[model samples]
Target: METDSKISKKTSQTILKLQQNEITEHAIYMNLAKRVKKQGDREILQRIGREEGMHSKLWSKYTKRELKPQKLKVTIYSLLSIILGYTFVIKLMEKGEVVSQNSYALLTKEVPEAHKIYLDEQKHEEALINMLDEDRLQYVGSMVLGLNDALVELTGTLAGLSFALQNNKLVALSGLITGISATLSMASSEYLSARSEGNADAKKSALYTGVMYIVAVILLVLPYLIFPNSKYIHALVTMLIIVVLIILSFTYYISVAKDLPFKKRFLEMATISLSVAGLSFIVGILVKKFLGIDI
Candidate 1:
């Protein structure tokens, strides 16, 4: 009977975990549904929420205990849904369900209801895919173009200027001037390209591209500006770090929301940006040596 007691204790612990997860997910879905404006999307979220609550109840029956939803988890996911869009938060949560599938499989050996809950979890993925129809997803390409160009071009330009000028203040001034001019030029080019392609929202597409580009420029150039009249090498290192962080963050966001491969995309982008910067740095050194010009 001692062996039987240990097995029972382990099973009870597993049931409690499932119970917590189900209740937490139910609150997250319901909170997301409340934020959604579309009736169809809201209804779908509500239906999923109801099903999660039922799953919690099923687990409760075996444990013979009540479990409260994880309030902090629900709050965090709800805030993420508000800021990152419902689709992204839902997809992120669904990724967690993949891990829970193993737990459910273990439970199925003793509890028949666990199998039914596992099947319902599979159905939720399909429903989530169909329900996600956010507008920002459509403009992702334009944003990518803006962000990538700013990172590659500005990083190269700043690296070149840093060596050529050998002064942080001069480098910062030159970078700001070049970045601002490029922002306007890129916006205009995007507008023309969109119009030529017969896109109905040409102006909006251009706006999104331009805004993203400017944001990247500001972030990338901030180090130089802050460290002006001081350590130029330190500023340059900081800027490179910022570029990597930007690439990492944007790649992760795209990978999660669009179901793209993150590692390959991130490595490709980082390699290209750093390669250009390295080439530009070498070119800057050669030009300064050959021309005998110092600013």
Candidate 2:
């Protein structure tokens, strides 16, 4: 026999989970606010934290229990905000907010206050979207250009060298030299391109491009350097796997930060890079077989 004043067992359980989430987020927002140096950023975080705490208190009345924040989760989001930037961390948290949003809809029928909390969550999203104007996000284009070029070019180069050279050290050395040369070439090209386009900070653009390119090159070339000469094939396999992982990770970051589609972007980049590597490997085999050049 259900009554208006009686909370259902299932709804209570959901409220408990939501209560914990609200409190956890309250702690994360407070900690993140402390870490940032910008006054405006701190204020925005503090406001959000206050709202989260208020919601937690609202939930506490229903549960009749005081719940502590998930300290580990708070620490993790704080560290990520530091290492990756507040925008990324906040947007990642926004992804979870969507699930919470859905739960709010379900709970609305059971609890009248749920609707108001749901509206508050919507406001939170709006606030989060408008609050971040980080400078680093502006250079995402340069980073993407450098990272994509390095992955496609170096992945192909290494795949070809693996078969043609049949020696891990030789492949690694060649890949490193090529990677370095390409990094320099890319940085200079980016500098010139930015300058021609009237960008005020062309040097910074070049720096981001160069740094991302070299980072990708290093990750791609490491397996070759680590493997034994007889395991050139293994190195090639490992390098390909690393390529996919880099694509997956970077694509996800861009998707979350920029609010873009993830699956389509990932599939496109992975397809292009892997296809180039595969074709290069085939070319290497044909070159070795037809030319009869023994390494």
Candidate 3:
């Protein structure tokens, strides 16, 4: 009696597994057929249906149990699977509502066996959505990247100008004007771009970018104020400022991304700064050689 009871339990579990696979296969075949619409649909349906039949045969072989119609379990599982799968696919598709509804209708009429798989997949989708929402800081690296860009470009502009132009009130004034104008222009563009983002945090990104630009510009002009009329000295000062900006940018990046080693970030920032400063210096020398005329 005990052995028979164990066999019955195992047979019942096997039947449930077979039914579940049938429901899943039905959903897959219906979705693929709806999207692709080829004779391959019949082939896919037959292949999956055969797998379900094989599962049933395996259960029969093991326990000599015949497949019975468990009306309640099949009905409940089928409805759940259809609902879950339909909900997920419909939401993901742009104009999927009409297509999803039509597919569901056709599926119910044509492939009733595979609906259970759709429910399992829907559960998986729900789990993924929940995980994404839980990890809100996933895009923080992007914010750090934007900040780094604002710092390097603005500071480099000031540094190159300091190198090329005489370190005097005029150069300082130019830096101030250029910094303010660039910051405002950048902030405005960022605001416009972020207006479509539909989040409070998006506006804050514009503010952060603007602030970094202002800070970088001010740092560039600091050496000029410290050593007035020292044009040669100021060239070295500007280079130092560029070095510091590179360091700060790298440090911020390292802090924001703790997984990245400091040496890697430092070398990366140094390479970029050197490349930019080299180009700017070359341009300045050519301009000074031709335009300054010093004549």
Candidate 4:
């Protein structure tokens, strides 16, 4: 490794930033490790944390100045780990690690050690990241089932009801009744399905599914409650917008946490949902025209 004096000013600055990042991640992982109850998880986190510290120390020889962990970053990750779980927080940090890997590539000419660090981070940390297991992630399949079904079913149902009923309160009431009934049905079905599969967490899986389904229901129906009877169209537009936003949000989360492709998943899910709603809206218009229904 070259001396700090020989390294360019720009290179030194980048090294300092990378060093701070490594120390911050070290703090976060160690903090989580201490807080974690599982022995296996604690060991993994501790090992990762120590490795980050080692990276930080290696970079320090170039910067030639001690850098403290960024307190704000550490605090934020700690809080998020508490609220969102360690799995989610660490997965989120993996994005930063990727950027660091890129930066390390750029530094290979000035610092040959950067290449080694990059490879270790890319390979070893990746394996460790995948090794991490959490209880919430265990029921992700159930949550996905709940969210996907609710979005596709309720969005279509609301679009049709908005046109057929032509009254905001009426649409909202119908949506709520339908949503609640479906929630119960979906939950029971999940329970039975999981039990049949011989899964031990069948009850918990059902709870996660029902809870995710109803939450989507509440958000979808909220627009109808807010708009007046005269503005059912506005309510319908808002509900559709909410559906897209929900898809985007959930898709982004899953992509980050599970390392899935975001654009394809988001586009596929959104297309299915909006297409169903569009078909349902046309059916509503046809049904009303043929039956001569009046509000």
Best by lDDT: 4
Candidate 3: segments with Cα more than 4 A from true spot: 1-146, 235-242, 245-253, 256-258, 293-295
Clashes of each: 0, 0, 9, 0
Off by over 4 Å in 2: 1-5, 98-102
Task: Tell me which of candidates 1 and 3 scores higher on lDDT.
Answer: 1
Model 1 lDDT, residue 125, Cα = 53
Q: What is the C-alpha RMSD of each candidate to the true structure, in Å?
A: 2.7, 2.5, 18.2, 2.2
72-151: candidate 1 lDDT, tens digit per residue: 99999988888778888878887776336777777777766678767867886576666667777888998999999999
TM-score of 3: 0.46
| Candidate 1 ranges with C-alpha deviation above 4 Å | 1-7
Taking all chains together, the TM-score of candidate 2 against the true structure is 0.93
TM-scores of all candidate predictions against the true structure: 0.91, 0.93, 0.46, 0.93
Model 4: lDDT of residue 45:
97
Clashes of 4: 0
Ranking by lDDT: 4, 2, 1, 3
TM-score of 1: 0.91
Q: Which whole-number lDDT from 0 to 100 does residue 22 have in model 4?
A: 88
What is candidate 2's CA lDDT for residue 233?
A: 94
lDDT of 4 by residue, 1-295 (tens): 3447767777777888788888999999999998899888899999999999998999888877777888898989999888768988898998765345567677887888888878878799889888988788888899999999999999999999999999999999999999999999999999999999999989999999999999999999999999889899999999999999999988987887778899999999999999999999999999999999988
- Per-residue error at 79 for model 2, in Å? 2.0
Off by over 4 Å in 4: 1-3, 98-102
Candidate 2 structure quality by residue, lDDT tens digits, 78-97:
88887778888988987876
Two-way TM-score contest, 1 vs 4, winner? 4
